[model samples]
Target: MNKRTNYKQEKRMKELEKQKKKEAKKERKLNKERMETDGGEIAGQEEMA
Candidate 1:
């Protein structure tokens, strides 16, 4: 019984880590897009003006 519970706990920890990594990747992509849009547009607009 102890072994089985430990196995389940380890599996859960792995799955949680995987999920956290996926979320971090998604957040990075989102931040990249935001930075690109926010940073580039100001310079582009200034150039236009």
Candidate 2:
């Protein structure tokens, strides 16, 4: 019983790690896109000025 519980805990931790990594990757991509668009907007404003 102890071994089985330990195995399950290990498996669950691996799954959690994978989920967190995926979420972090998505967040990073979103931030990158926002940064890119912000730069574009600034350039556009500068050109208008």
Candidate 3:
């Protein structure tokens, strides 16, 4: 019973990690699009700073 609970916890952790990664990827894609539309210049300036 203890082992089974541990296994479930591990699985839950992996699922949470996957969800976090997915959200991060989505955020990055959106940021990229916004930067492109606003102008790559903004990103370039940020890099310089």
Note the Cα lDDT for every prediction shown: 0.94, 0.95, 0.89
- Residue-wise C-alpha lDDT for candidate 3, range 1-49, written one tens digit per residue: 3546588888999999999999999999999999787787777789999
Cα lDDT tens digits, model 2, 1-49, are 3546588888999999999999999999999999999999999999999
lDDT, candidate 1, equals 0.94
**Model 2: residue 46 alpha-carbon error in angstroms:** 0.6
Better of 2 and 3 by lDDT: 2
Off by over 4 Å in 1: 1-5
Q: Is candidate 1 or candidate 3 better by TM-score?
A: 1
Candidate with maximal TM-score: 2
User: TM-score for all predictions?
Assistant: 0.80, 0.87, 0.70
Write the candidate numbers in order of decreasing lDDT. Answer: 2, 1, 3
- The predicted structure with the larger TM-score, 2 or 3, is 2
lDDT of 2 at 23: 100
TM-score of 3: 0.70
What is the alpha-carbon lDDT of model 2 when measured against the actual structure?
0.95
Clashing pairs in 3: none
TM-score of 1: 0.80
